[model samples]
Target: MDTQNSAGTLYIVATPVGNLEDITFRAVKVLKQVDLIAAEDTRHSKKLLSHYDIKTKLVSCHEHNEANKTHQIIAHLKNGLDIALISDAGTPSISDPGYKLVTAVAREMLSIIPIPGCSAAIAGLSVSGLPTDSFLFLGFLPKKQQKQKQALEAITNQSATLIFYESPRRIKALIDNMRTILGDRKACLAREITKLHEEYIRGNLSDILKALEEKEVIKGECSLFVQGQLEQKTIDEEQLEKIIISRLATTELGTSDLARQISKEFKVSKKQVYDTILKSNQIDS
Candidate 1:
């Protein structure tokens, strides 16, 4: 209710990730009352709007056009047209569109409202059944496998639980890679979150990999959570071997990125990580 002024407000509304009924009453009310709704996918959001009988006008605000659309939205707001910003699902700007628009609006001294609700990351973490004392939300790994491994290698020795968003197509590969890099840590894969076909597979990386292998073809987006390395404050030589072997198996980086990352992580020189890889006899010199 931050729209007490005549200047239009920008409401960052959170819609359901999967279940339509998961939306809050306040969100529904704002969506119905807003002058305009800047949606990530106007076509996809139409279903939700129609379902709720909200007749507010919608404008596309996806990644490809967010910059241009931000100015248009601001013009409307300045003209005293309250606008609601929403993504196809969940809250906007959480690995989705809406950041630029929010920043632009903030500079204009506009009232930017937040209507928080369900998020796939939080939903997956709450039931991950792992130690959630501290966690990291890695939105998505790099598309390049080596870059992804490099990113993983950087945090392999961290003490916080790791959460990642992965698509179904690459779910198997991600597990295989994680199994190699993170060792056999406890993990959970939450699929089709908040939907009818939602499923949670809880176990170690190997267990989940085997379970996924048994499937014909997995469906839906997945939220993977991995327990952190806590018991061993420091990585032992044996643990380093496992880490090296795993990265070699899944990464295309050969030894460069891995070497640089592990060297920095373990407080050693690049030569050390390179020497470890050479000893593993996996990569050529």
Candidate 2:
């Protein structure tokens, strides 16, 4: 391959997340033909390249050196050098570092092509036995408890399945927090994806937490898929009014505060609770 002749095109390649066989035929061919290959972790990618007998030159392109490497990659592209960007696993720039380089190259009107293939997040979710029509891919949660809690709360009422990437160390804490905010909703913890030890733990949030607690320590990377809300049975307006009025009577809090708490507890709108409170007050008056 002539390095000088192959300049200008940037190939964003998707490598196998776990199983080497998951790689696409086109991805392998592009990787082989590119002048240079930029990777998240060269050593990790080396194994994949070695498996496929790909001899393309590898360069380090990851979160740490992304800003610095972006210029170098663009320089290669400007000079008509074709380059391939790959992550340690899965697709580049999907919660990875290829974004900065891709964005920079695109601004210069350079050709960038995607060689799509395996992605653990999407692969796991596809087989998760959860809602697939709509989903929110929250790549990774904050490490801090409060931030994670706030993050989970922000999406608690979403009607779509929530997909998240989690580290083995923080997965327990993540599950614990989900239980606190999202109740005991069903979730799937898919780990060691597509590998020999691949596993998926499917159950309510509490059960998954307990299972993790019993294990010595989880080893593989994880992708969590949480089921969304199911249809709710309609409660009679009068019955709901009675329940709210009676609960408010036993509490000393103001009507608005009481209504807010009831709304959250019952998964009903605050306005509905407020209207019930007003009706109760009118009847008493």
Candidate 3:
């Protein structure tokens, strides 16, 4: 509890991602006492505050308005008004927009307190059943397929569990790209975290993809946790063929050109794709 004496303080509060019960006692008290709340989404914050019967003034402080709002928030703080900043879900600035405001406030010698609580990223990793000692948090992959694949390829060699947030619409495509870039590594797809419909699909990329296909439609926010590289069998012909097909769908390249491209992307052999393409063509014919 770092509250400035005679000056207003900035409280960086963490709200529940799914389960409301996950909120901490100190967080609730600070929210109630704060003169103003700078939230990523005021309407969303209102619901949380109403749930606890705590009515406090809330102002929008998201990525879109953070730059403009930071000055206003600081002005209020200088006038001795204590403010609390929170995100729509989880801790502010984890994957949200509180960093700028925090930095601005600190530069002015104002106290900033962090009221930590539930975070879906940590929640998923804690029970992911994967290696957790060293992990990297990749907030979200690029929307473009090629860029996303390139990003995944860059981190494929890291010996740490990789955690990422993904939307349901792109989850399948992401998993497909991951399978291409990272091979059939052990992974878990945790969704509807902390809620009643919470589910964790654990296995290699292929198995998880099959499980997702069986579902009518995947729902909720998703956190994808992937195990790092280890001593495993090399990527087989079938996997190479799948990557070739995926790239072909998204890019215009001949079988020979595609084979070379996939080989370079996954650090595999062009012969592997050439042979797999030959086998695939035989099956199709």
Candidate 4:
């Protein structure tokens, strides 16, 4: 393909997340026909290439060297050499390497195409039995316990289903954090997806935690789909009024502070609560 007059195309291909047969035919074709293949791990990708008889040259493009390789990849694309970008598993750049290279290619106005296929996040969500209408994909959380809890707290009010990827070692901790910060909502832990020993544990967060405790050792990578925060039932005006009065008499919380606390707890407007508090004349406006 002599596109010397014009820059070569950059193909973002998707590979199997687990099962070798999960890749799309288009992905295989692109991999074979491309002038070069930029892989997250050359050794890891070699096995997949060998399986399909693809002899295209491979270059290492992982997190450590992705920034440095981005320039070289762009140069190749400019010199009329079509290239394909793929990760060890699933599509590149989705919580994986290749984001930098893809962005560089796009900035250069080169033709960029996607030969999409398997994705673990989507696969796990499909079988999670949670609401599919809306979802938020959080690939992984911070390793520190405090940071992880803070991250979960930020999403405690989200109504969309939450999808997270975790390793077997930390799956237990991640589940516990979710339960503590997000409440014991329903969840599904999809492990070893699309593989021989694939398993899906479905139930409340507490149930999943109990099951994991019983296991001798948790194996394989895991994708957890957790139910989002549910809508809080509105508190009756009379009940709300009484609570406001009781707080005013019992606590030192001022009108503004008390209104904020009550509003958050009951999912009502802060102004509404504040007005009710003012009506009681128990706290100064």
Candidate 5:
């Protein structure tokens, strides 16, 4: 390979999430032909490689090592050796480390190709039986319960279906936050997708949580899809203003809680309701 290898390309390949044979033929061909494969976990990837009889060399490119490995991988591509970036499962950059490397490579004016195949997010949405025209893919929420609730609250009023990825260990906790903050909106949980014991449980968030708790143990990553907020109806400004004034006079709810309660009653966003409440308070003062 020429040191000035200007024609080098970076292939973003997609591996299977659970089933080995789910990989695309083009992906397999690219992996075998690339000069090198930068995998999230080379050890974990070896099983797939061995199953497919791929002889290409693989190097570690996970979250811990990606920052250091980026330069080396870029150097090889610059030296005219084409390379492929793959994750332990699914596409390279979806909630993975391929973003940094891909961004760096794009800056250098090298070609980057995508060999798309399977993605757990898309797989879950396809069969979720929810509206899919518009969606928000939240890879994972924060670990803290408060932070997770705040995150959900921020997007509670969006009319787009919400999708999330979770591990078996924290799936219950995540559902708890969703139910608390987003209410028991219709949802579906797809577990162990594409595997032998794969299952999809459909219901409101609370029902799904209750069912999962009954199982002695759970495993595999979970894909969750929630129906979007109800369509906004025609709101009456004067009517809302009167309700706010009456509620303040008649009830002892704090401003934030009042906003939450009123927002639900009127099918408006919490932020909008809160902002109006602030303005009302300022005007009274």
Candidate 6:
């Protein structure tokens, strides 16, 4: 309903993740009405558009070319040509391309609309059976082994449910890493969601790893929903101080970073950790 004066609106459309019928009626109408559709993959999106008989012109706007395409998209918007942005599946900019274009459009004081429909993360979370009252949607983890561990260690004490997206090829490796870092926590692995072979493996991280090992080859993208730290043990001040001092001696992490990591790991106040760190620094000085 809200439209830019004379400029065209940039609609962030959400397409089906797998099953075509999963799309909403509103999304279909917008795709049909838009002057042009900017897709992450034109060839891949053509199948969906063809299924619904949407004949709107398609253009490439994927990660590789998104930078060059952003300026072009803005020029079209300035010329009053409404555009719809979509990805190969699910919503654009959700671990997909479109963030840069959206940001550029907003800065130009142009109208940016959202034609919300299906999101893989939300779809996976809805049926994950994990506590959804509070959640942390970490779209994907770092690829490097050490960086991956660092990322996992940073959130080791998060209380909210954790949601992550991973490729089928790397799903098993990710689970192995998680098991090593987060313990054998309860989890749900949603694979090939909304498709014929859609499967949900519910159990501990170890169970999921075993399941992956049994399979000949994993297929499709995967969403891993893991339970957060459900218990926090009290840390004695003296013991915590010694632990912090030892960590400082071994790691190059600064005061703030060390305090955060220690507080999360120990379930203590960051201020407490900071005070201990400061006192230790004074003593060493």
Clashes of each: 0, 6, 0, 0, 0, 0
lDDT per residue, candidate 2, 169-218, as tens digits? 89998987776566567999999998999999999877888888999979
- Report the C-alpha lDDT of model 4 over 75-185, residue by residue, as the tens digit: 988888999999999989998998888887888878888898889999999999999999999998999998997898688789999999999999998987676557568
Give the poorly placed runs of model 3, Cα more than 4 Å off. 1-5, 231-285
Give lDDT tens digits, candidate 3, residues 133-152. 99999988899988997798
C-alpha displacement of 26 in model 1, angstroms?
Answer: 0.6
Model 1 agreement with the true structure over 10-91: per-residue lDDT tens digits? 9999999999999999999999999898899989999999999999988899999989998888888878998999998888
Q: Look at candidate 3 and tell me the lDDT of residue 25.
A: 94
Q: In candidate 5, residue 50 scores what lDDT?
A: 96
lDDT of 5 by residue, 1-285 (tens): 212446678999999999999999999999999989999998999999999999998888989988889899888887888999999889988987799998888887778889999999999999999998999999988888788878888897888999999889999989876665665689999999999999999998878999999999998899999998876655788878887887778655578877876776467778987888888899899
Looking at candidate 3, what is the lDDT of residue 213? Answer: 96
Error of 1 at 181 (Å): 2.0
TM-score for each predicted model, relative to the true structure: 0.82, 0.82, 0.83, 0.82, 0.83, 0.82
Clashing pairs in 6: none
lDDT (0-100) at residue 232 of candidate 6?
A: 82
Poorest lDDT segment (10 consecutive residues) of candidate 1: 260-269
Local lDDT at 11 for model 1 = 95
Runs of candidate 2 exceeding 4 Å displacement: 1-7, 231-265, 268-285
Candidate 1 segments whose C-alpha is farther than 4 A from its true place: 1-5, 233-285
- After superposition, candidate 6 runs with Cα above 4 Å error: 1-4, 234-285
- Can you write out model 6's per-residue Cα lDDT over 1-285, one digit (the tens) per residue? 434688899999999999999999999999999999999999999999999999999999999999999999999998999999999999999899999999888988899989888898899999999999999999989999899989998889898999999999999989987765675689999999999999999999888999999999899999999999987867799899889889779755678777866776677888999999999999999
TM-score of 1: 0.82
